[model samples]
Target: MDGVTGLDVHTLGIIGLAVGIAIALSFSLMSLVLRGMAALHVWAAAFWLLTFAGLAQGYDENGSFLSAIIGSVLIALANAAMLIGIAMHLGHPLRWRGPALVIVLFLLIQVGFMVWPPSQPLESAVFGLKSIFWDGWMVFFLLRAPRELKAGSLFTALVFVIDALFYVARGLVSLHPEMESPELASLLTTSNYLFGILCTFLLSTGFTLMLSQRLVHDLRVAANVDGLTGLLNRTALLKAAAPVLQANREHTHAVLLFDLDHFKAINDRWGHAGGDAVLQHFTRTLREGGIPARALLSRYGGEEFLLLAPCTSANVAVTLAESLRALVERSPAHYAGEPIMFTTSVGVATGTGTHIQRLIDTADAALYQAKRTGRDRVEAMVSDPSAGDRVNEATSAASALT
Candidate 1:
């Protein structure tokens, strides 16, 4: 009761809750630790939160001095366990020489402090050293807590630093047993401790928020992107194209469609491995050094890509279509050191708020005509056969992607 009188009941309750939470967290965090990608947060949180409680309880207990030292050793073990768990999850090798030494020394000091209480004037330096070492560990861990450097390890270190710095400051205050003004010293010391607690709270909360934000962003990008081809997936492409189509009410637009000619033959000749290499390589070319950062490029289907050229004229669309055709003809990818020749028939259609579906249908017809006329040729869509006015066309060339 005498020990409890000096401590704020609220802080005591918080410390209790933190320890209870840590016990609950072990069940949840252990499973994730076994998995490769988990944050390992549940255990880290509980471990650190309860650690403060243990330290406070140890100091408060009127029992033998060794209890506090044992408590410190237990907390250090939890930190060590967290580091190992994180390294396993990341598949990163651990080199714990420096940090391990700091932890071992910390345990030794805690035991020393219990064995030799601070009531004696000669014990001041020992208390100060222990406090300083605790602060040192905190700083070291904080420095290492980024994803590239073991984020979980860094966060856990920061929490310990907070706890350690608080003790060090308290130890420093105790060293000056007689100050200029006892009341003033007490006020300043209390403010510092309160602020340290706030900083610790911020470190935990801040990382939690940051991690959640990153996870959400990654999940969203994965859902909307084609994992294999790295383009806007089918659904995302349509969703993006829908808005562009609706806005082209006053201007004519073009759709240039291209399908890789003799693609299946390459798969048959080489192998599915060769086919995949070809697809990935050819898609890079189709991107034409990357869809105009502003333009939308999408994989419409196997060996088929759609480029939506907004408010583009037939002449411009034809030129771009031919560009794509020429690129594909020249960029014959190889697998197993064998050059794999491939080509695509391109179709282009220009329409102004007339029929978007017709735009694609007309291009499809032209694509078919190109394939029918010759395997490696471009053909324009003729809106009226009698007039022979080719609204979309491929240049007369043997090589499609020049």
Candidate 2:
């Protein structure tokens, strides 16, 4: 292999090929393990395409036009695949027409260059511009990613920008080769191959980090959220509200416990599927009824939900509960051409302390009172100031109003 100073371009290419293959194999295995992540499969395919592109370009001893065209087209397709994978990862709709057009135009331009034998500088400029186009598109999308994935997305975008800068430098240097020393040109070529190997590894690592972050976030959400109603589960609600409750002992916090009235009867009349529809409908109604943003809402158990609102007074809590109850009563869940009307009984308790369980117990007592008096009503209880931090028993001061 010819050496550019102490560095060998051929050896760098060989190492890049090995590294690309290893990364591709790793992605392929990950895709198999994470079958739901479609982006991984696309990325794996992209790497394989890149490897083939390298092989096609490397073994073309005579610089044959066919081999050159094959290599160029394969590389363009590989980049296109990568862009598509990014789109998939971000949950964006795939639009392949533009990338396909770019590839076709690249192929046609390569054919033109082969036939007319363009100057080396012009060829390098065109190649570099093509790369910049794709890199710019990828950077745009990465920058537009959601804030939660900002770290990984920004790192990947930075790497792409650096790679694009290298291409720009290569084109600029090739443009005025007569002004530079032979050693400089050789060094640039060697540096290009070395950068290629390094960039490929970095890109792969960045993508894997992005994927791992997404996976961890999804796992956490799945663990905390109720699958049916898409609300926080009991344990999650309790865990999340603990800090809020403990933060300010003087602030009044309220817990609203809601029990759907006659839930079992709905299931009996409409089957389990219809009952599920009603549950979803109730959740939507509660959301649409202007629930406070600061409130922590969760499905506490079967046909029961709990909402913890910090800095809420007794009056505000009761009003919110009444509003939700009325909203649920009016909104009917439809299933199989039948409307299933349902209602809920609510228990509201307000206290000034970190005793969350005490507040919940007081709210549950109020809820029991509401159910006992009649279903589909709101009952409220407030802690007695004389009792200090202890949440007092349910009070009749704010009685269930029909």
Candidate 3:
């Protein structure tokens, strides 16, 4: 290995081979452990093909015709795996029939060439064209990926585009009569090995980062979202609603607490499964109830949900609550060919303060009142002046947060 410019050609090839093996192993573990990301399995297979291709190249250098043919086929298969993996990641439907046939035809042609090797220029042309075609396919898929993929997608695209262009240029250069010389051919091969090492390192690191980023995003979503209803959890709701309430300079903020009436009876009659279905049914109605996107909707607890709406006035809050109540009353949950009717009692309270807890407490008081007076109705609570002043002062001083 060179000491100044880093490792020599042989060392770089060894390192590249090791990296390829490590990538295959790492991705295999990721696929087995995660299970959900099937694309990692595809990528693992791709790296395995890459490793085989490398080994086959060594056999080819030793004049092993059969091994070289197998390696050539593995190269095409590797490219195919990479393409399929990208498709899976992007939520795209992969129609493999056409591409599979093309790969088969490519393999046959390469095997035929190995059986009766062509002259230097002809062989270079064939090999270069094959490389360009597959690299171009990669570039096409990367370009078509959604913009939301951000850093990972962009980095992968750049690497593929450069690799594709390099193959094209290499093909054009190989047409020169000078390229037929043994020294030139050997230099070209060595340069390619070096470049492959760089490509492998870049691709493996980029993909790992992409996987890490996706894991982080999924974790964040899981933390904030309620598993049963797919709504925000209580913590997330309060965290989100605080800013809206605090910044309410012109409009009053209203908190509406909803509780399903006779929920335990539904559980007792229809079982836990039926109760769950009813809850999901009500959530669907709420989502379709034309609630403003800015409003925070959350699963406060079992059979209870909270909505913080920035309304024009208390009247608007009451109207909104009444409309939601009516919507739930009309929609019925169907379980086992039987319709289960249910209703929700809502408590709406409008206030002019940054203290979200105070608002929730006031709304909860009204909610209990609704439950006591009648099972299915909406109730509004007026904030006491002295209580409001104390809350505002405490909210300004302590600014306690959950």
Candidate 4:
């Protein structure tokens, strides 16, 4: 095949090797900076293996059996590694058995070909079929990715689909060897090399973009979520609720404020670790307690939580609050195999319009009332004629207790 085209297969192989090595190095560096992303490391190793495969195939001037077998196996393994890395990135479970069986079968076929050398077209057909299988497998997974990763996933899937089409064409062309003149064969080889280079670069770029998108999503989550309870933070809750509140101005919204009763005592008795465990326990209870799907639940601050339920009535809000209080009271948090008794005080306020701050203030006043009367109780204040009357009443009552 040498000198069939001005830029020969060997030259293309060398260029591919150089490009693979460069990409491998970039992925390796990315793995270092993005420490926990195991996909980056896997992809780096895959590129290195692909480079080795290129080297094994490129220098085989005599088309040696050993070089052929080694190159085929390494190339297959590299493709498998790429699929594995993609699974890792998407948090999908790795099912090694299927991929392993495919690789073993592919290796056996390569070995069979080496033992009884077939025509060039037959060999090319086998290679093309194998390439198509792997590329198709990658496309399947990429297309099924979650909505959050749709952009990068779709782009990468499209690239793989194109690659599969190339292999399909190669296979079809190889089947009709009688139609392949010297000039046409040369053109196909040149096209293959150029397309191979293009696909390799595109695959790497697509993977990098996926990693970038994932990183951005993770950073955004970290910023808006409470590290301990995995609940939305105050800022995130406000940001999320503002639009909903404004959109449903005609509908009533309920804001429920909850303070864990005697939280400091729990910390004092069982230490901060125990306190953390209790907080987690409470969070789980809330999740399992049939909270409305559209409720905006957040960790307002230490030992304080807020829930904003849109399109809810005052009665429903108070009932929900009481249910939560009872649930918490009955469900004891265990620390060191001992049951740690604890409870929560809930204050609920319901109103129409987009005055989220006003609703929160009213809920705060009611929360003060709950604390004053008795901890572990549910108290509620509805929006009165002036909207300030209930808040004033609760505040005056709270002041009397003080």
Query: Best candidate, lDDT-wise?
Result: 4
lDDT string, candidate 4, 90-170, tens digits: 878787788889999998887888788888788888888899999988887888788888899899989999998998888
Better of 2 and 3 by TM-score: 2
TM-score ranking from best candidate downward: 4, 2, 3, 1
* lDDT, candidate 2, 65-98, per-residue tens: 6567988898999999989998888777779998
Q: Runs in model 3 with CA error above 4 Å?
A: 1-16, 57-69, 108-133, 136-149, 384-402
Local accuracy by lDDT, each model: 0.61, 0.84, 0.77, 0.85
TM-score (C-alpha) between model 2 and the true structure = 0.88
Structural similarity to truth (TM-score) of each candidate: 0.60, 0.88, 0.83, 0.91
Clashing pairs in 4: none
What's every prediction's RMSD, in angstroms? 7.6, 3.6, 7.1, 3.8
Per-residue lDDT of candidate 1, residues 234-303 (tens digit): 5676678777878776776777777888888888988888988887887788776434444677777787
lDDT of 3 by residue, 16-86 (tens): 78888888888888888878877778888998999878877762254476455777778888888888887
TM-score of model 4 (CA atoms): 0.91
The TM-score leader among the candidates is: 4
TM-score of 3: 0.83
Clashing pairs in 1: 22-46, 145-154, 325-400, 325-401, 326-400, 326-401, 326-402, 327-401, 380-392
Model 2, position 97, has a per-residue lDDT of 98
* Residue pairs in collision within model 2: none
